[model samples]
Target: MRLILVNDVSTVRGGATKVALQCLEASKDAGLTCAILVGDDGEGLKPQFAGIRTVALGERPLRDGPTFTDVFAKNYNRRAFEAMEGLLQESEEETVVHVHGWSQILSPSIFYALAKHEVKVIVTAHDFFLNCPNGGLINFHSGDVCHIKPLSAACLATNCDKRNYFHKLWRFRRTLTQWGVGEEFWSRVGIVLVHEEMEAYLRYGPLRHFTTLRTPTAPLTPGPVEVWRNRRIVFLGRMCWEKGVRTLADALNKTGRTATLIGRGPLLVEMQRALPHCFVPGWLSDEEVARLAGEARVFIMPSRMPEPYGLVAAEALMSGIPVIVSSSALIATEVANNGAGLVFDSGDAASLADQLAATDDDDLMRRLSEAAFSLGQRIAPSRAEWARRMVDIYMGRSSFSAL
Candidate 1:
């Protein structure tokens, strides 16, 4: 069988593209015929993995704005459609199309081509862009989580597009078009959810009819499950309001706790000034970040946004580090259910401080460290293992759902 990976970018920057790259590498190692189809719109050095098939159809229009045409046939790039059409013609019968994300880079046009070819497809929910009009399920004016039913009149009317009503109208139009395409595309494909909570959300929203399967991921590499010391906490990922990193730093400062911020973002200098005790070393290599995760006493992910897949938390767990994540986050659910770490109320600074103080007990840290290590064994999948399981799903060997 053939495995075709589809994502927005040719380079790995964020969660969706990184996972797509991982699948590409693993599928080739497992002796599966695989190719990656990307729109090289995002700025980065293109990846050139040896002995792997990598195809870039074209780039998105520089600073392209949407029009009524985008709501119609213009959403499909002619080059990408041709590329996918050729790929489908060659291996249409046995090809499994695994689509990661499609927004600014790749649009919904390719889905139409896949539908025409009747190729089996699997869509991984990296974000809610497919259904939610606002990109994330967040209210723009209020900066709060939005639970409105997707595509409803109320949802369409809500100006939650992060800019203004004009932007909201644009997203609303795009989402309307997406709903049309997704109805046809998802009906002919199965869904892959990184977390069960995402399954719950999707089942009750758009694409609810499509079959879904759970695919939990582990860290890329296993770190030594070292003993826990009373070292400072570590915060990885973007340092922004949406990530709640600033809130976390505020809590840490208020509670007199110190931690390390490993990422760079708009609030970096402000955060450095506010949390005088916190250390900001900017972006580090993944190896260095993993090493720090292993050495740190605890990891904190106070995301105010609803993170469907918590890769940062999984990586820390692999290193035997417990997480103190937002209660509303999917990772927090994993920690609370499995004893991997503690949960603070989402976006609540005082509650975060309370949880941060609770981790001061050495005995509790040791217990959490051991439990996180055990959880890592369950969540972390080796590359080969992930490839084999994905092949099973591709070949109709397994199926799962909350239903």
Candidate 2:
């Protein structure tokens, strides 16, 4: 069987891109003929894909200084359509196309080309692009999660975009073009949700066929974290308003605790100015982050928005570090219910501070740490198991029924 992995970028810069590469590497290991289709210039392609087949469309993202051509190109990229059609034409064996990310560069036109092919198409719902025009299901203007049905009159009138109404209108137009691909094309498509809780938000979307797939997780570390002796709070993600970086900063200040904020974003300058006692290192490698995790008493995911799946929280849990998740996170209830983590009000600094204070108890810390480490393994499949599961789905041997 042949496997075609599609994504916006070819490198491991973002979570979605990393997941796509993992799928590619695993498919190759499983002895499946694998190829990659990238929407960008594919700069700094990883060494693992050195000899593998790859097609990189030399196109700029619409957000990067868009031109007059981008007005229509962002809706339906004709070049992407033709190129994908060519790939489908060349395939002689049964093929499966798994698309990871497309909204930024490839556009919705690739679906038009796939309409002509008889291959199976699986789209990983890494974000809410399948339904919400903004791809986050968030009201950027109000900084709140949106529940209105996508593309409805209410959705059309609301200026929920991060930019302005004009940008929202453009996104709505693009979403309409994507939906215009028709029911027939969508019939062959299956939605793969990274988290089971995602179904609650996306079940009513246009796409019907759905399956829950565990994103592969890194193996657990040898020993549990020594939480009782640690005092540093660690947060690993983009420093943005939606991520509740400001909230975390306020909580830290309230509790007189120092934290290591390990990420870079628009809020970097502001955070540096406000938190003199905290360490605001811009970004770190996975190895660096893992090393720092050993010294963290607790990890916090203080997202203001309803996070689809907080992967960093899972990583922290796997390290046996107790997590403090905001109620907005989809995994918040599970973490709380399993006694693995504490949950606070979404944007309440006081609530987050209270949770942070609770970690002072050595006995409570040990209990939470042990629970987190034990439950972390069930959050996602290992790398090899994820590959085998994908192969099963590709071969129609999956027992997963539509939700």
Candidate 3:
């Protein structure tokens, strides 16, 4: 059987693309016939994906700031449709298409193209795009989770887009086009959720058919870290309001704790101004981030939105670094229940400050670090094992397995 991977970018821009590239590498190593289709020119193809078959569209990502044409083209792109149709025509009879991401460039037109083919298609829910119009299920204006049913009167009337109502309207239009692709198209498609806990939000939408597939992440450290010697509290990811960077900054200020901010986003300037004493290095390489994480006393995932997975927090746990995560994140319950991390009220600086203070207990730190390492080892799978599981799903072997 032939397997094809589809995503918006060929390089590792974020967790979704990183997972896609890793899957591609693992699939090839497992002796599967695999190819990748991406929206960009594939200029930044990493060393591991060197010899793999790749199809790049040479299109600019809409996330890089949409143009006049991108405004309308994001809903449906004839170029992407034709490209997919042509690719499907040449593929083997028994083929599977696994899509990691598309909102950035490919658009919903690829779905229409897939509807014409007989191949099985699977989409990973890296975010809420399959259901929520804003792809976050967050009211950006209010900094709260949005409970309105998608496309309903309440949803349509709400201005939840980060930019403005016009952008929200555009997203609504795109979502309508996406869902209108017909029941037959959707019936044959299977959704892969990164975290099963995300079902709480997705079940309220039209698509209920799905399975959990945990992305593989190698542990940064070989074993539990020496948590007592470390003093830095680190927060990594986009510096945005939804990510709760401001909240983290406020908490650190209140506690007078030494913290490091690693990432670049709209809120970076604001965070820098808020915490003049803390380290605010813009963005670092993967190795640097991992090294920093290994040395950190605690990692923080201060997201205000309902993060589907929070991969970095999991990575921190795997590295034996305890985390302080927001209850709004899906992994917060697991980390708290496993004794791997502390859970703070989402968007609450005071609560986060209290947790920061609690981390000072040496015995408590040691226990939490050990538990965090154990939890990480338990959840993280080998690359080969993860690839085998992907093949099982592709070959129609299992569904409904929990991670």
Q: In order, what lDDT does every prediction score?
A: 0.73, 0.85, 0.85
lDDT (Cα, tens digit) per residue for candidate 2, span 1-403? 9998888777565678888888887788888898888888777466778777788898877645678888888788888898788888877998999999999889999888888888989999898898789988789877778999898999999999887899899999999898898877875588888887787777654577888886887633456888878887899898888889999999988988899999988799899888999999889887788788888899999998778888889888888888999898889999999999899998899999999889989999999999999988788787778888877877788844454
Model 1, residue pairs in steric clash: 218-380
TM-score, per-candidate, Cα-based: 0.87, 0.95, 0.95
Over 4 Å off, model 3: 400-403
lDDT measured at residue 211 in model 1 versus the true structure, 0 to 100:
43
Which candidate would rank higher by lDDT, 2 or 3? Answer: 3
Q: What's the lDDT for residue 177 in model 3?
A: 92
- What root-mean-square deviation over C-alphas does model 2 reach? 1.7
Task: Tell me the deviation in Å of residue 157 in model 1.
Answer: 2.0
Q: List the residue pairs that clash in candidate 3.
A: none
Assess candidate 3 and give its TM-score to the true structure: 0.95
* TM-score, model 1 to reference: 0.87
